[model samples]
Target: MVRILQGLAHKYFSDEEAIILLLLLVVGTGFIIFFGAMLAPAIASVIIAFILQGLVAKLRSLGVPEIVAILGVFLVFMGILVGFIFGLLPLIWTQVSALASEAPRIIRELQSYLELLPDQYPHLVSAEAVNTVYQQVSAEVGQITQWLVSFSLSSIPDLVALLIYVVLVPILVFFFLKDRRVLISSIGRLLPPQRPMMARIWHEVNLQCANYVRGKAVEILIVGSVTYVAFKLLGMPYAALLAMLVGLSVVIPYIGAAVVTIPVAVIGLFAFGWGTHFIWVMVAYGIIQALDGNVLVPILFSEVNNLHPVAIIVAVLFFGGIWGMWGVFFAIPLATMLKAVFAAWPVKTLERSPASEEE
Candidate 1:
């Protein structure tokens, strides 16, 4: 046991930097897990600042001065935030509330369809099975309604939090951008000076995460706008809400597309019925999804290189379960960071020779 412990110690604790890295990882993860909610605004600010750094770099590449580029990016961020708050959020909220209110009628329509299963396809589907499904659907609808009601009831507190986030995030983001070097230097001062592994991981993660976040933002806007336009042309009900779901669906892997499809199909069926219009609506939606997954995602996230789909999905589920929406949003980057760390971690290699074996 002493020999084994000695071997383990030699493998992991041979270097002071390794000890420091391990300590930092444990402490950082603990802070994130324990006080994440309390630090959400700050965390969110960091993410937003990272995203906007791409724009700053772009402006700098175009011969813009450093301060000018930062100012431009900051102004653009503020404009977008203001627009989202005043123009987009209210519309999305109204649509969401409307969707919740219409749930009962939608459930009724689904139940009505289920009722015909026994008569229409008696051999294929039994009344008992149909009724079972009907019960499940009804229960799900009730749960959804309950959640919406609870959410509405708590809107005041939520709004207050939102207001706080709105005021704090921008300030934090501005300072984060303006003093990026100073902040980085401050953080570095706390870490062991000789940290090749940590530095390598940080460099890779920073590059990948900045590209991923900025690309995701662009993808979301493009997808949402395109979907909204198409839905509007088709006269689809709740176009804005459905488009928003379609846009955000890009965050999760296959699961998001599958889940969002439920509402889109439901709304489409309710709006257009089983007609050519409904068929067209579905085709259009399918096209949007196909383009996003096959074309847009690849083009935008090419900088992410070769993240396995399974890894991405697992990250989405695991981190999302732990930290909810923020986790889901950062899942890919976090997974990438983990992968980089694992790759960068120094592993002890044993030289197996006759002399060593004899010893």
Candidate 2:
């Protein structure tokens, strides 16, 4: 057992640089695990700044001064932020309140439909099964209602935190963008000057993550706008809310789309019933998703390394479990970072067997 342990250690961590890199990763993960919530504003600021950096760079490349570029990007960001707060949010909120007020009616209608299932398919569905399913759904809806009540009652602290983020995030992001070089140099100074493996891993992770985040931002905007237009044209109720869900659903790959479909179907059924209008809504949604997956994704993410579906699902589950929504949004990039680290990680070569060497 001792020899096995020694061999394993030697094979994996023989390099001093590897040990240092591993320690850095461990410390970073531990910090996020313990203090991530407290530093969420800063983390969010960093991510926002990182995404905007590409635009800044593009402006600079077009012969704009650095300060001008920074100001331009920051102003556009602030404009969008303000517009969302003053315009889009109120619309979504109104829809949400309406939905809440209508929930009981929706549920009763759903129950009525469920109750007919046994009669409609007497041989396939029994009244007992329908009752059991309805009971479970009712319990789940009851829990959701309780949660909404509690959340509303406890939203004071959250609102305060949000205000702080609203004030602080823009400031942090501006400084992060303006002092990007200084910050990079300062962080660089803390690490060993000779860090080939670290450099390699950083290069890979940075390219992949940056591309992913920016592409996703664009994807969300395009998908959401397109969905809103389609829903509005179809006279769908809560068009903005459903459009937002459809947009954000791309973040979780397969799972998000499936989950968001429930709400879309429910809202459509409530508004248009089980008729051609409802069918049209579903058809439009299907076309949008198909275009996004086949056309938009290929163009936007041509540079990204594709993980296996199983690996992607596992990453989504693992990271989403740990960090909730943020984890779910960043699962792919996190997984990519892990992949890059493993690819560049230093390891000692083991001795080849004499029989294999002869062959």
Candidate 3:
């Protein structure tokens, strides 16, 4: 046991730099676990700043002054933030309330239809089974109602926090972008200068993460914009809202598209009665999804490497479980970081064989 422990230590924990890297990782993990919710805005701002850093760099490369470039990027960021807050959010919120108010009527109509199922398919579905399913459905609806009531009542505190975030995040982002060099230097000073493994990991993560994040932002915008145009042309209700949902669904590989499809299809069926409009809407949506998965993603990630499908799913489930939307948003990068660390960690093989020894 002592020999095994020593061997493992020699392989993985031989250097002060390795110990420092591990300690930093542990501390960062602890910080997230302890203060994730409270510090969500700050963390979000940092990520936004990270994404916009590329834009800033590009502007600088065009011979724009650093301060001017930062200001320009920051203004664009603020414009989008304001547009979301004052325009899109309110529209989405209005539609959400409408959906909520109409939910009971929809449920009643669905129940009435379901109640006729046993009559239409007596051999397949017994009356007793229909009754049991009806009861379960009703109970689930009641649970959803209770949750909605609680959510609406509890949203006051959340609104206040959101307002605080609105005030704080821009300031943090401005400073982060403006003083990026100083911040990077300060962080670099804490690490050992000669740490090759840590430096390699940082470089790889920075390059890949930056590309991935910027590409994702572009994907979401393009997908959402195209979807909105399609839905609007089809005269669908809540076009902006559904388009946004469709856009964001790309974050989770397989599950998001599947989960969100139900609502889109239901809404279309309810509105257009499975007619040509409904068929057209669905077909267009399918095309959009296909293009995104096959075309946009491949082109965007062509420079960046692909993550394993299983790794992505596991990361989405694990981190999304922990941090909700934020976890899901950052899951790929987090998984990549782990992949890099594990790949670079020192390991040795003991491959001495009896046949080889004899030879």
Candidate 4:
């Protein structure tokens, strides 16, 4: 086995030049991936600042003090956020409370459905087994609150990190917005002479992140509103909460829509007595999503990218596997950047353009 491995390694290195070239390419790709992940926070911050930086710069250019401009922008943004929270919180709270009260009934309905299945096929499952499972679930119910508290405690560090980000981002954002030219020039100085091309590529990638901020906010609100209204009309419990979840998840792209709908459909099944009515609600969700994907998103994010759906799926899974939920959240934007970069590459451009046009 060792001899065989040695022979393969020898052959691989026999062409030393090719081996070095391959290694360099591998290292370069790894560096780009690593750099992307590492700079996610700063990238997010910069994009956010860019949205308001134009206004800030305009104000300063027009004789407004930097402090006043910053304050005005911050206050305007905060007012928008506050208004949204104030409008949505009550409905969300009410639905969440209603869902908590209905949990036992939902569980009971599930138990009944399972028991009925066994009755329809006695050899498949016994009454004793069903009862045992129900009893086990009932026992676990008492531990739910304890588990939640423990989970919260375990996530203290993450909570702290989030708090740190909350505090730091605004400060970082202000400086970035105020001194954007200086910062960009400083970064350019750090790169090698030949790598100005790479720096420009990075800058272009940064510019594209605004697509996520602007596009996602609109998409999430629309999807969430549709979900809330759909659930409420269906008389599903926790309509507001479910809608919020569906809306939040919608930002994650393809899989998010399904994840948001399934539980709501299940709850609707129990609430509406398991019939065509329940099925109709699920079908409505599908229709709404289809419209959103085919009409709403395209209209809203027309220039976002035209990458294939399969590529989006691969990105979500590939990155999500590496970094968990955050990976999934960033996947689409990252994928969009990849699509834009490749499409804009010199070779692709030259191929598409006529020789006279290029010259």
TM-score: which candidate is best? 2
Residues 1-359, candidate 2: write the lDDT tens digits: 99899888899899878899899999999999899999999999999999999899999999999999999999999999999989999999888877777778888898899999989999999999988988887788777777676776789899899899999999999999999999999999999999887888888888888888888899999999999999999999999999999999998788888999999999999889999999999999999999999999999999988778898899999999999988998898788778878877878988879999999
Off by over 4 Å in 2: 146-152, 351-359
Q: Superposing all C-alpha atoms, what RMSD in Å does each candidate have to the true structure? A: 2.4, 2.0, 2.7, 8.2
* Model 1 regions lying over 4 Å from their true place: 1-15, 146-153, 356-359
Among the numbered candidates, top lDDT falls to 2
* Candidate 3 lDDT tens digits, 26-90: 99999998998889888989999999999999999999999999999999999999999999999
lDDT of 4: 0.71
**lDDT measured at residue 234 in model 1 versus the true structure, 0 to 100:** 96
TM-score of each: 0.91, 0.94, 0.90, 0.67
lDDT of 2 at 140: 80
C-alpha lDDT of all candidate models, in order:
0.87, 0.91, 0.86, 0.71
**Can you list the residue pairs that collide in candidate 4?**
none
**Better structure of 2 and 3 per TM-score:** 2
> What lDDT tens digits, residue by residue, belong to model 4 across residues 1-359?
99767665665444444344345557866774678566656766776787676567779999999889988987776665556557777677666556656667878887888789677989988888888888887667536534544755787887787666666666777677768789989966654555433545465655565655567767888988887788778776777787788888866776787787777777778878878888888887788888888998888776565558799799999878876877787788778777655443332111234866877
Considering TM-score, where higher is better, how would the candidates rank from best to worst?
2, 1, 3, 4
